[model samples]
Target: MIQLHEQGAYYFDDQIYLESEKKNDAWFDPEAGKKKTMAYKIMQAHNHSGNDRILELKFDSIASHDITFVGIIQTAKASGIEKFPIPYVLTNCHNSLCAVGGTINADDHFFGLSAAKKYGGTFVPPHVAVIHQYMREMMAGGGKMILGSDSHTRYGALGTMAIGEGGGELVKQLLNKTYDTHYPEIVGVHLTGKPKPGVGPQDVALSIIGKVFANGFVKNRVMEFIGPGIANLSVEFRNGIDVMTTETTCLSSIWATDTQVQDYLTTHCRGNDYKELKPENGAYYDRFITVDLDQMECMIALPFHPSNVFSIRELNENLEDILHETEVRGQALLEGSDVTFTLTDKIRNGRLFAEQGSIAGCAGGTYDNICAAANILSGKSVGNEEFSLSVYPASMPVYQCLMDNGSASALMTAGAIFKTAFCGPCFGGGDTPANNTLSIRHTTRNFIHREGSKPQDGQLSSVALMDARSIAASAVNHGLITAATELLQEEKAIPKYFFNKEIYENRVFQAHDQIQKDLPLRIGPNIAEWPEFNALTDDMLLKVTAVLKDPVTTTDELIPSGDTSSYRSNPIKLSEFTLSRKDPHYVPRAKAIREVELERLAGHDVRQTDEGLAAVYGSIQNHFPDFEYDKAIVGSVIYANKPGDGSAREQAASCQKVLGGYANIAKEYATKRYRSNLINWGILPLITPDEIELKNGDYILLRGVRKSLEEGSNRFEAYLVNEDLQKINLGMEALTADEIQILLAGCLINFNKKEVLV
Candidate 1:
């Protein structure tokens, strides 16, 4: 259903051509030609760089959820930020379950409100709305740019260029600094033909994700949606697809806006924010993805990743073969673990079954998606046979409209429980499935342990992603895996949505331009100050604490989300859980290295603490005669094939930093946000050759590490200080000037502190 063009393409008259007839024409100016793209216009408008190759962006507004906002505010406050320079929205959605951490979640919420009041920002109370939903309703504007702390922060359907990044990026905006980067390549996503009735937006999204994610076709690039098929989908339908683009690892996304988009903003009472956005006739793209929406089928992304997609029809046809392959893959993924992962047990009578069904979060909990789901389950019931269904509307406004229009009643009557607006399930905080069970969800992701199944504790479950329509279809069949098209009936007529703005008026606190200086932040006992970080020394000796051979390691496995989110405000406490899910030994290993650094700082003899390290220091001295063991900072490092796949949570990198991590050596980083998190935390995002072999406990002595960074040397020479100290090459890829300064000063906060002092 989706075709990827490997070469540069041109879009004309709503069609994509890999090589246009007008190519190489004397009249065409490649520099001026780029202006035809909608991304170029939006980015140029926000760009502060005099050169088009570099981008220094200042977003119109910024957003954060409860799990992130507190840390962001703390960093910004420490950096001497007095007030928010731009609109900042803090939504208490992720940490809505205040009881998880014993008043810590609520304390973070109170701190968010107090900070909003003290620093001229906006705060949405718990369950009022999910972060992206609130931004869509009130903050998103046509051609505007928004930076959010959560990864799925995509508002492309509304013609807004929204980027989900690490919390440090948002802190830069709070401090009136710019988000610096090289100009991202633009990829044209040309949609053609109408989607089949049962094929919802998630199906289309998964098809696209399955095509692009594995090859990194659209990674760190802007996905500009343009095509005649854009007119065939509703704004809500477009939104459901757009929000999931984060899974593609794209930097940001934007779409051509039509009357449908105009009407969406108008209905939400923000008509003035609407503006028509379309690519110029001869717009050029670095690459192109042509999606035949008509060919899309009820899709399911099997356990572990959103990109492991297959059509429901194909999967059902080859059930045994597919399940067996998945089981083998699961075995490899969960190798050396205590838990026994199995999916074949779920199959009975040649059909698969799921224990739970969820249609919630930004990608699934839209008014149209829920409305369509309610229609499908109008008279049918989700029979109580170990199968349950729950629906969470995107926002209070959507909830009110669903209730008023009888959609809520239809779902409730069909035994599907209705819930308030919350983002807990999407990140493993709520509605976790029973051990060894399978869940079908319409949420954003289905990564391992993301459903709150602690595999370390012998509790392992799996989640498969599907469209809400298919999820409801499966629910009605009592969790028997079924496609929505199998029992197709007359399409339901969706009522015109009437947005109730009063829901926000009474609940949300808008503190913009109303800064209260005397407001004290309600800090809980769990909330702690950031640990002091030391500046980069002349030389460094980093011991590899953990080595991950996984193809891609997600953030969930790094610091974990779910219940651990409640401890995000406390760096030291949260660091204890770093890599706890993936490698249970990583924390203790990292802590041992941290203790060594502490001992060195206290002027203790290194040989007294760890006798093995004394030999490695002697080996390093043999290579560099001038090298001083006492001057070299001792820290920990981790090597992975490719790390930082999912989530924009800064704690993934910060936790490592808290445990005295100095660098991360990887073949490549999975996402820009993850790499940026490492940079912001003053950890070197080192790039190594794919074939390089390094093991845990191997020490690498980086000579002139600080000097190399300050001098803009991309490559550095290091020796593996083992029994045989051999030379190894290490390098960093594409660090901005600010990033270099951040590293030199230890971290973004320290970098900003030095700036303020200067």
Candidate 2:
């Protein structure tokens, strides 16, 4: 069970006290207590803004995988970056299984190698490691801060404070600029109990996520792990929980370091990087969470989200009612499609049955988790049903260790397929399940379509998240969804993990921070430059191309992952897939509007391109005879209840930008990274505090738009041109001076340089 303390609290002497209970204590001074957190210390070391209120941070290292690096490097190169200022590791894990795109995946890998050689960075070959795993094995250092372009970039368990963000944030570091943000609120995650043997880190993490995500208790706040419970878990167990902190929508996470952390770093050949980190006598937390790991049970997160969690015991007792509710939700997700999904049908003799099982990615593929699972499935078979099991180690070194220790062979002998290091299972790129089947996975997310089921293509599948132990147990039960605890068997005789650095030394291309200035850059045929972007105009018009009524919309819905991500290096081609899954007609509609804007930019009359647009202009002129067409720009916008929830993939915003998207109207943004993505792509993040009626084909016009932003106006007047002019006001949060500059210049690229490359 997890308990949330919404009221502010402080941690002292391994005891948490709310202000109401501890105001009498001498250590209860809020001002001094704020500086006692582990997060504050790490941020203080990296912050160069001269003050703690606003952090202008410089990370010690930055990283990105193939799904992101090509675009990030292209942006930095356009901004006149000559050499990487800090350690930059480009890993090829996300696109390692490239069965969908022809030769493009390998092409991106070669380009990463060329970029690494030319800019003095490190390039890890395909299957070398997933981004976060490689960072853990090599780059994580105690008391240091790292930034990555992947959402799950967490190394807090290793005593490193790491943040996952969009590519623009990485570009700033490459250009020796600062990552600007107000000092984030810190939340103390106090753990005091040891987890039961059958319960893995995913169970503890999902329990916390289920308690916190829906209420936004820790949104955009740093979660600091501390307490007596820290010493009870191994370093890898802490890592499994830390990496999934991204699901709680937290900004970043850090843990108090112990001798175990020192040992972990030492084993990875980084003993000197270890540092003692702990909360001072008293540390203030804006919010607090207490996780009782002793009561943790085998957990499962049903389809559609990682936060929709329940204990396996609870589900078994309430099977019928829960299945009915999930069936209804699944139907909503498959609405207007030919696909039909019913979880109730999976029931066989009153027990739920799934068709596939996966234990992979940064969350589940750690050395400890796999060894435990292999031990559980040592002599048992997964059976010859449709139920198949696959396992992927987090890194090649981990795989090699398993191979050396017979863990890999044990799983393979039990009919479980072993794979190399890859993140495809986490993002729907590989190991996709069959239609209408249920997959029990130990990956990071179970969001709709996250398991690579394309409902648009009349295929649908459901994914439920469980720990590797439960997944292995269910595999032995012919996918009957059994809890690992019911089997009453624990891991025994597991060998110690032996990391093989020779794997990297033999195949990885390490530039060693020495720039190869004379080396020629390699350009892949599929890699394309970004299209030209126009700066903001005094007058702006945005056509509503799509309206989503979902309570929370993820980045996966904005621009899908998997096969569509293959075109990310080419802005034009990638933009074509924008909203392709959620709104199939969005691209054509945006493209049509883009054509009209292109004509306007060329000094041609945009009214001549479309009759409806001509009529709208006439109506605008009729309302105000001085309407200025020359000072205006037209684009598209999308309205969602709350958007940008899941991944930190910048293509969610960049693809929209390349397709003529200028703004997004949402009640609130789900995560900081998504909003940053929007700003980095020059798209305005607009909010509507009150209900506003909107339709797909409606147009909203804002006069003196650029002037309002320049004047620092938080709310601006706008007209919604449905039939008659209707007054509207859209709210905008105050932007940083740099953010405003980037918007005015159209994007990060234009803000950094005046030269335009075609």
Candidate 3:
């Protein structure tokens, strides 16, 4: 059970909390109490801004996976980055499979190693560890800040405030610039009572996510975990819950660190980096959440989202009803598509089944999760039917520990396959299910087509997020949907974990400030430089290319994942897949708009391409006598209710930019990282009225957009182009000074190319 308190609250030490406004005046100071939070202390320590209202932060370290590094390095290189100023870790985890058409995946890995050496960073070889796991074991320290290109870069359980952001942010760090933002609201997550047996960390996390995600209670706020529950969970258990915070759309998360955290760091041979971190007495929280772990159930997030949750017991009781509801909701997402998304059919003879089971990635691949699965499936078998199970330890060290403890052999012998450390299963690079099947995983997300189902090709499948304990329980029953509570007997004692640092030392490449300035970067055939982008012009004319009426449009739907990720190194090639899943016509429509811009830039565009545009220009001239047709920049825009959920890949916005996208008009952005990505790619993030009507091919002229931004006006005037001009107001909210400059310069690369440092 989870309870939310949006009204500000104050906590005395870690155990007791009282409403801030209702608290006694004996010792109440909102400002002083605000400084007592663990998140505030860590952020201010990393803050370059002298004042508390604004933050110009430089992280202790940064990280990127293979799918992101090539573009990040190219952008940083184009922006005049001499060397990495911090301990940058480049891990080859996401694109580990060299199974794409050519050698692009392997090529990117080589490029990462070269960049690590040339820029004085670190590189973890493919199958060595995931980006987050490596950071947790090797780099994370108490009170340290880490910024990563991947969205699940949360190490809060270990006293580190790590944030996963777009690649542009890392490029800023590489160029010695700061990550700018204002002070964020801190939400206190008070955990009391220990988790019951068979209730894994994912169960507790889903309980909280189910309660908070829909209401947006904790969105964009830092979740600060405190209370007596801190001492009950292991470091890895806390990590399993912490990583899923990304799904709640929270900015970042941190938990009160204890001896367990100290032991975790000490075992990883970074004991000196451990600093005791706890919320000081009378800490103030803008929002407070209490999670009763004892009431947790074996939870399941049904297909299409991580928030569409239900207890396994509840699903079993209402079997057809729950599945039917999910099928109906999922069908809505695929309404115009050829494939029929169904989940009700997965119910076989009153028993639900999953075709596949996976326990991997930063959340599920921990030693604790893997051991729990092994214990549940100790003497049982997943069977030799269509059902299959696979396990991937987060790191080679975790894998070694699993092997040492005999869990790997036990599960493998029980008919589950054991794989090397890789993030493929988590993001659709490996273990993809057959068409129309369902995969129950302990991975971070369950977005549509995330399981590698190509709906466009008449293939469709879905993923249900569950704990490793429940996944193993279901696996032992030959994929019968069963909670761990039904099959789990007495809890077995887990073996002591021995951190194997030598595995990384031997396999990973570490650049101890030995920068190779003269070494040429290995340019692979698949890797390509970004095309030129123009800075913001005087005014802009935007044609609505795609209108997504979906409740939320995710990054995966924006640019897609899986095989398309093979082209991530080449911006032009990758752009071809923009909105391919959500809107098949978006690319061609956006490209047509881009062609007009290309013609205008050539000084030959005079209504020759399309006569309708000439008429719109005449109308614009009637409204403003000084209106110049050639001066207005032509680009495409997309409207969504809420966009930018799931994944911190910059390609979601960058792909749109490469295809001549100039703006994103949304009622509200789903995450701060997504909006930042849009700005970093030189796309305007506009907040429009919820009832504002927009259709594909409708044109809108933004009058003096550049001048308005220069004048620091949040509201911009635009005219909807039709037979008659209709006025509309667009809002750009809370943009920082640094963000405005990036937009004006067209993008972070172009902005940084001028060597402007903040």
Candidate 4:
């Protein structure tokens, strides 16, 4: 549980936290010298190029979740990549259930397993482990750097610096291309004192998250943990807090190591992994955040987002006012939806009432949290009713530990069903609630549709985030929504844990080739090959198939994954539903356009007959009388202010590219990883600011687009014309030197294809 002051507070001298009227300068710009100094030492470790925004460095390993591995592998395969350049772990946690395209999910798993075997990579079967959890237990090490396809890939808690990037960056790694970035400033997240009993790390983290997330205090900055609290917590606890830092959207994280950390690595059979890391005594920090754990209390993040937080006590004491304020804020964020949600509905019985409870995913499905939940739920029946509770272990090892230590029996005996380590419930993929149901969970995200709802089609389910302890505490009372602190005050109970490593020793396939040969992998048929894409042309005629007016469209809406996850490997089948969920009419409109492009490419003379083709062709012919409609390749593109956010799912980009998508037009991209994926797959990364009028359904013709890209020109002339022949000038965004060449070559594959010619 956690407590937060309305005003910002800072811990000074590791003793007390007081209201700090001063700005957060420790991160913005800290004192010049002394222990309070926050700075960057690693930038000194290597040289970089381009704007300081790009960094080039060597990494210890790379990883990807269910959503990203399929396309990352497909891109690498296109680039003639035969094997992984570094240790790559493909975990099937994101799309564990075969929800879409019949067998698409299973096919992707097969592709992963086969690629792992063929390329000597590591493969984690569906529901075996979440991507982040597996990486922490098996891959993290001191002073090492890792790149993952998922944006939440942060391992700095264990002395490892890991980055969550777009799949294009991962493709570069797979193809032996260097990860480019300007070095980042390291902000010291100085921790002091131990978290009081009954309080969890989530409490401390939410407090920090509340302060930093909204203002982008640490955006694209590295969080380096130091100070005395590092000695108090276990490596797993540190990792849990570190993983959530992704919610803050920071670049990466690293923590100072101690004996508890060393012993944890040693117990995992990685004894030599012990290494203590800290910045030089007076290392500079762009900023400093000193967290005093003693004052922390139990916390809860309300529905919709992890950043919506409040102390249970405050909400209970001032329920009416808080709920009213929350309603106003929700209305503002929801944009005029009849989202009839009111926390004050619980005020009738003088208590909070939650309909569902869940303890799952990388944030909550830990050995200690599960063990603690088992202890709380033991000997107490959850009562057969609508308030159901489910517990999911993060990995087989944690599951085995719970069973071996009698924790699993405790929860099961108490009427709670234990489930596999699937990431489904966290996303909309698994355990969806009925319409209007409100579920409370201890998961990574609680975004819209994250708990399984389709708002566009009129179905809405919501999830509120809580720590695992509180989830069980509420379930014990049949969902009266009691806080964990209240239960602890009534009865004191602390569970002991016994680490069990035998299951991993027996079941986990180590990174050895001999052991890998005997393991058989499964593949299904719904998987399809990636379609061929033409290179950037001297001139391009692009038809805007989809235009999203939603302020922020999540990657989930672009390509609904929870349902279509199973079809990740099959290009044609998956493309059919490109914008089906978001805009039900998108597929037919896209198909109509595709037909004209198809006939034009096939050399059919349909210019005079086809209405859709006649207008588009007539406009192009007026500009360059010699231009041939059949010779000009046509494709679709999606425009949004900012896209490619939330999940690291590559299908969001791949599905569009496969359905004849040639580019993405956006004001800015959400993450570096998503945009890179667009470029690698032969889609143009187009940027047309507010000055350009890019109307939906209009044909924007880019003449010498390929040459401009190859020549590394930032600005190029493009003509925007309707079927009526009216024309206007449009411009393209400047690209990095390498980005331009990749576009001209038709994608990374074509670039590599030219290698054979060399």
Clashing pairs in 3: none
The 0-to-1 C-alpha lDDT of every candidate, in the order given, reads 0.89, 0.89, 0.90, 0.70
lDDT of 2 by residue, 1-758 (tens): 78998888988888898988988988698889999999999999999999998999999999999989999999988887888989999999988976667988889999999999999999999888888899999999899999999999999999999999999999999989899899999999999888877788999999999999999999999999999998999999999999999999999999999999999888888899999889998788888998888888999999889998889999999999998898888778666677777888899888899999999999999999999899889999999979999999999999999999999999999999998899888888888888888999999998885668677888775889999999998988989988888886554755887777888889888888678977867878889988889898878888999998888899998888888878888888888888777788999999888888988888998888778888888888888788887668899999999999989999999998998999999999999999999999999999988788899888988787788889888787788985678888687877888888888888888888853342
Alpha-carbon TM-score of each model against the true structure: 0.99, 0.98, 0.99, 0.86
- The candidate with the higher lDDT, 1 or 4, is 1
Candidate 4, which ten residues in sequence have the lowest lDDT sum?
Answer: 30-39
lDDT of 2: 0.89
| Native-referenced Cα lDDT, model 1 | 0.89
Q: lDDT per residue, candidate 3, 324-411, as tens digits?
A: 9998999899878889887777888798988999999998999999999998888889999899999999999999999998999899
- Tens-digit per-residue lDDT, 1-758, candidate 1: 78998777776777776655567765444456567899999998999888778999999999999999989999988888888889999998888878686888999999999999999999999988999989999989799999999999999999899999999999998888899999999999998899877779999999899999999999999999999999999999999999999999999999999999999999989999999999876678888888888788999999989999999999999998888898888767786688877888889788899999999989999999999998899999999789999999989999999999999999999999999888877888889888989999999998885878677888876999999999999988899888899877556778999998888999889986879977877788888889999999989999899988989999998888888888999999999889887789999999998999998888988867767987887777776789887788899999988999989999999999999999999999999999999999999999988476888888888888888988999988787886677788789996888999999899998999999999
How do the residues 354-398 of candidate 4 rate in per-residue lDDT, one tens digit apiece?
Answer: 777888888889887887788778889788977888889999888
Clashes of 3: 0
Candidate 1 residue spans exceeding 4 A from truth: 24-29
Residue pairs whose backbone atoms clash in candidate 2: none
Give the runs in model 2 whose Cα sits over 4 Å from its true position.
489-493, 755-758
**C-alpha lDDT of residue 691 in model 3:** 78
